[model samples]
Target: MKYVRKLPATDRQLSNQLIENGWKKIKEPRNFSLAVLFSLPFSYLLGSIILWLAYLLKPTLFEFLISDVLSISFSIDFKMLLYILFVFVYMLIHELIHAVFIPNFTKSKKIFFGLNGLFGFVFTTEPIKKERFLVISIMPFFLLSLVPVFLLNLLGFLNWYTLGLCLINAVGSCVDFLNMFLIAFQVKSGHTIINNGFETYYYPMQNIT
Candidate 1:
């Protein structure tokens, strides 16, 4: 594996930390807006898979249970708008989950927070072990999407709002998923990882040609 520094096109606060800490940016910054757009298809794909599993496991219960939820029509009413606002607020909490796990994984409370170009981020300048970084990367998804959605679906209360929140948060987690994918599959196990907004930096733990 060859390592080289690449300048990232981002105005995030973490960029400075990366430079100061002598870590090389391995890739360009991924825009949150672009990530959101790219995640929609995957979100729908996940939804389809869940639905297919439900049908395969329990067709009658699944169809009868979700029928009302599916029948509920979308409307541009005040309540609908309020639900939208709630989802937006929940998104802040989503980013906060990423922040909260930083110290646990890195053993440092020196985390920086910022928002730029439709992205809210929590990052550290310090590099972390690949396993800990993977946990931090996927924590928000488990907290926001997997737990809530699974519980709601299990309790037979999977409404449009719950489903929408799940889908939206799942889509919002595009960057996390991408980072995890790269770390788990693309990057080797010994590399140290630092996430700066959309830019993921890798520090080689072993000599690479």
Candidate 2:
């Protein structure tokens, strides 16, 4: 999907607007190597912990459910695959929702896709004020992340793998939760004034236009 952000009179104008609201436009990293470096092992470790908890909670039920419903032979490896795939798809859609919503801002926007370890983000380069940003950041979690968990739980009652997948989906929203909280806090810091004193910072170089 594509998103566009209309640029203001000039980059300086946009940058000034951002700075007034507490946003400092920094140069894009030559590589997100450090981010990846921290995220890779982190993903594996977190994924492992989640899988272990699932195994402990319902070893027999989990094994049986995967074997019977998913029609996969019972094995630790297969269950691990199911866990990773479930989490990855859930998170992917969450980020995609952010991308789709950006077009409302401007005709120019930029999006970058890469793995931050096993996790990823779709960021926009456009400078958005705080009020609009609340919608952009919170919408995905509400519409894509949480709503899917409710639906997936219904399916989970019918299939064990689906239940496992739903669990992963719920947990995967932690990233969204953190993003929302950080943005909200930044908005509250009285930086970028929007309607009612809400402020949102912009990342120009990372914008997807």
Candidate 3:
């Protein structure tokens, strides 16, 4: 029971869709810009918090890792071009993470990978459990960002390659974080969440009428 709440739609359009599917939309749809901007501060805070926890868990190891990341010194000849390319590639990886989790969580082959409004996403209309949904949402940050950084430290390789990847992926994950927040705050355990690849809907087990 990590989170429990009624489901919500982002707007009237999604509201109608959810209603058509026999699910209740309990909240308004969030604007694209607002959703992206709202996650910036929280992402930084969460990044800091994770660092602090890492330090507390292993002070010496954390210090070494920090030093390694900080010691990475190099200049890119085509920084802007590289940044742009990396973003597209990393975003693909991010969406792929979501897509990969679909089969595990849903019995449907209706998964989709595409852009919606101002963002790119992997969407599905399949019903998924709360815990599994969270895992699907958070997997990219863990595999693409966290795991790479951890491995960099463990392998005694200190460079900007993995560090940059982590940072880029972290920033790119703002939307996922927002969705995770909404789901965690609004949805209860044991309930199924349905997504039409854009908005998510939920119905209470005891009150589906």
Candidate 4:
């Protein structure tokens, strides 16, 4: 829930296990300028393209479906705002899952919340095994993104609010999707590392003395 001030004895044990398994710990950036520069544009561009395509191909369908389910009868702008709010809440929930799940195995828990330009993220500062890292990285997308999208689609009605919510969900999922790929594909390259806005760790292994 809070950033860890210091690594406790239990944290040391967890770190040890991670090191033995070739998992590495990374430091959070003091400034997020680079992360913002890299992630925000890409995420926005990709998000725009996807939304445009969805709008063009399924405008009538989306409208009908969202209208039926949300049923709020609000203006399109108001509905869009609510949808964005929902996305923010969903993102928070996704991060909370990471925080709650880690305590079961790790002694230390640290969370950083900040904006990288237009992109925002929550990440753990604690070191974890690769398996744990992978699980945490993927959990948000599966539970928060994929499931929500599927359910919303299944409901089969679109209104301004639901349409906005669906788009927000898609964007949120896209952020996680990119992160999952980085974690699954990229390995530690020297001391330089990237967080990938999910849970990917890019850093050198700390030598345990």
In terms of lDDT, which candidate is strongest?
3
Off by over 4 Å in 1: 1-44, 47-73, 104-109, 116-119, 195-198, 204-209
lDDT of 3 by residue, 76-163 (tens): 6797678767777887788778878765424445565665543456766566776777888889988877776667667866354545
List residue ranges in candidate 2 displaced over 4 A.
1-74, 77-83, 104-109, 153-160, 188-209
Candidate 1 per-residue C-alpha lDDT over 1-209 given as tens digits, one digit per residue, 9 for 90 to 100 = 11113323455666776677766675433665676566566567655644554445436645656565566455798998898788877787887787676645345554665554445666664567677778777887778776776687689866656767866776677667766665687566777776654677777654321
Window of ten residues with lowest summed lDDT in model 3: 1-10
Worst 10 residues of 1 by lDDT: 1-10
Error of 1 at 43 (Å): 4.1
RMSD of each: 7.4, 9.2, 7.4, 8.6
Candidate with top TM-score is 3
Q: Can you rank all candidates by lDDT, best first?
A: 3, 1, 4, 2
* Candidate lDDT (C-alpha), each: 0.64, 0.49, 0.65, 0.50
Candidate 2 accuracy as lDDT: 0.49
The Cα error of candidate 4 at residue 208, in Å, is 15
Per-residue lDDT of model 2, residues 87-164, tens digit only = 688777776776667654334434444455566566555445455556666675466434444564445542455545
Checking candidate 4 for backbone clashes, the offending pairs are 64-158, 65-157, 65-158, 66-157, 66-158, 66-159, 67-158, 67-159, 193-202
* Candidate 2 structure, TM-score to reference: 0.48
- Model 2: lDDT of residue 197: 14
lDDT of 2 at 87: 69
